[model samples]
Target: MPVNYTEDAFNGLIIDTNTIPTDSVEFGASLTNILAYSAENNKGITWLTLPIEKSHHVGRATALGFIYHCCQAHELTLVHKNQPAQFVPFIPSHTVGAGALIKNSAGEILVVQEYGMTGYKLPGGHVEQGERIEDAVLREVLEETGIKCEFVSVLGFSNKHPYKFGKSNLYFICELRPLHNHIQILDTQEILDARWISLADFQRDAKNSAYNHELFSALFNLSGLQPQALENNKGAHKKLEIFFANHKDGLL
Candidate 1:
């Protein structure tokens, strides 16, 4: 059977690697046919996704001019530009992280200190692939501080460049209500300590970062963004979480 593939809006083709033959010889022939077809049709680019089992074929594809694009889980995606100047592939440029600013009934805030952290910070971490921002913060809180919390709203976010891998970073501080007040450190390696501190003490403590203190203040003084329900008619994409002004009175 001919190599299974689909055309992209940019007149590019995305090859179905599952249809590729595992045999080296057959793989080469199939790749050649695809490339020839792409060139004749003036395709802008071609994307090839290879599963972990086909790692041996990576070198072969690279030798044919495929460049590493990105990787996830057990698969690696490579790209070849048929018309280099016509189409530019999108590169991942930023990392998204969520911090849980959790406060309990006792007016105490949840905090954690990572191994290298000089001051206590919120319990949080990077969002996982295909995970929602709200879910990410909740998971991070549980992972870092063994706390179960309810996501309230996003208090604020910080943006910075020159982060890991030269990519920009966006860190969102989310206000959360603690459902379980007890604190336990699940992973001792990443977390040095986890505990509850009075909000007053947190604001006055010299060991606490100013950034965290400001985030807490925002929770009480500012109306942070609230997640709004969104509907997607295009069934191809995943569910999206949209944040907008949480004003009770509608914005004119």
Candidate 2:
């Protein structure tokens, strides 16, 4: 089931190849070389190239589908030519990461400030090689916030920014219940400060805080859970129920 991109599939999407202004023209040349190299190394494999219009909107999906199909079919390369052709190397794998959407008894959201990163973010980190995503999230939350948590429900998945370390296509969003008192917060070097902010406060500060806004946006869309204002701090446990009720249909 090698996925091939047909011209008709990219009929009305926008892909501005001209926006990639590189002097060396290395992208296209490098892509070409990779395809050739892959073909020579993998016997019985053939590369397919398709011209993608500059105005295609689903480039990422298309590219993903192309790679998935090529890998499934044991093909070596699938190339896309816009103003310049780009070759995507295929590597099929999965990685685990954890995220916690924690709330206090008052229904306020729990957020932590990283030592060097501006703005408060939800407590989370990568799941180590032998750890489960939920367990990793609970450990990270405890280590970063000093609070043991009961895993409640999964929110959904997200694909993060591609970087040199590698690309993670899935992130688990979990609802958690704190099992300890909120004493004087102990700052882990991993975090400089932590607090529980009301959803109202989160909304008010989101526009002004880059970190708040980015995190909120990711959390909001990642689970497709409707944002709700908690009625009282006593009802923080209910917030997870609301989120799960609204988004359970799509949870992973």
lDDT of each: 0.80, 0.54
Q: Residue 218 lDDT in model 1?
A: 65
Error of 2 at 102 (Å): 1.2
What candidate 2 gets wrong by more than 4 Å, as runs, is 1-94, 183-187, 206-252
lDDT of 1 at 242: 79
Taking the tens digit of each residue's C-alpha lDDT, what string does model 2 give over 5-93?
21221221222234422322443443344444444543222234333432132343244333322323222224333323332333446
RMSD, every candidate, angstroms: 14.2, 15.1
Candidate 1 per-residue lDDT, tens place, 173-216, comes to 88888888888888676799998888788889887789778767
Q: Find the candidate with the highest TM-score and give its number.
A: 1
Candidate 2: residue 233 Cα off by (Å)? 39
Q: For each candidate, give its TM-score against the true structure.
A: 0.60, 0.47
